[model samples]
Target: MKLNVLYFAWVRERIGVASETVETDAGSINELLDELSAREERYAIAFSDRSVLRCAIDQTLVPFETSLANATEVAFFPPMTGG
Candidate 1:
């Protein structure tokens, strides 16, 4: 499936792009991350610390184990602070 993946804040900085369309066969968000992490050194660096990452599928926040079935968008970012 093709997914429109979004990166926010430092994720964008490290990956050198804010967003991109990715063709993936990942069944879940965690698997997707693993796929991207293997793409290049920059991707590995951007997603190095999974603990600091938060994800949302199609705008609604979801856990990494969430399935990607029928999902067209996925976003990754750091946890938000109280501000």
Candidate 2:
């Protein structure tokens, strides 16, 4: 499937792009991340700690295990903090 992967904040800085269209055969978010991490050192660095990251599928927050079937957009960002 084709997915639009979006990166935010430090995630974008590390990856060096705000978003990209990716072709993947991943069944879940974790699988997609693994594929990306294996692509280059930058991706590995950006996704190094899954615990500090947040994800949304087509704008709806979801767990890493969430199925990616029929999903077009996937966003990765840091957890928001209130000041």
Candidate 3:
């Protein structure tokens, strides 16, 4: 399926793009991350530490195990902080 993958803040810098359209055979967010991690060195680095990452499917925050079926967008961003 085709998915609109979005990157924010440092995630975008690490990935080298703000967003991209990708064709993936992944069933869930974690699976997609696994596949992306295998695509290249940068991708591996960006996803190297999952603890620093957060996700949203079609704009709704979700867990990594969330299903990706019928989803049109997936966003990855760093953990937020506030003072």
My TM-score estimates for the predictions, one after another, are 0.98, 0.98, 0.96
Best by lDDT: 2
Ordering by lDDT: 2, 1, 3
Q: Give one digit per residue, the lDDT tens place, for model 1 in 1-83.
A: 99999999999999999999999999999999999999999999999999999999999999999999999999999999996
lDDT minimum window of 10 residues, candidate 3: 74-83
Question: Who is ahead in lDDT, 1 or 2?
Answer: 2
Worst 10 residues of 2 by lDDT: 61-70
lDDT of each: 0.98, 0.99, 0.97
- For lDDT, candidate 2 versus 3, the one ahead is 2
Ordered by TM-score, highest first, the candidates read: 2, 1, 3
- Angstrom error of the Cα, residue 32, model 1: value is 0.4
Candidate 2 error regions (>4 Å): none
Higher lDDT: candidate 1 or 3? 1
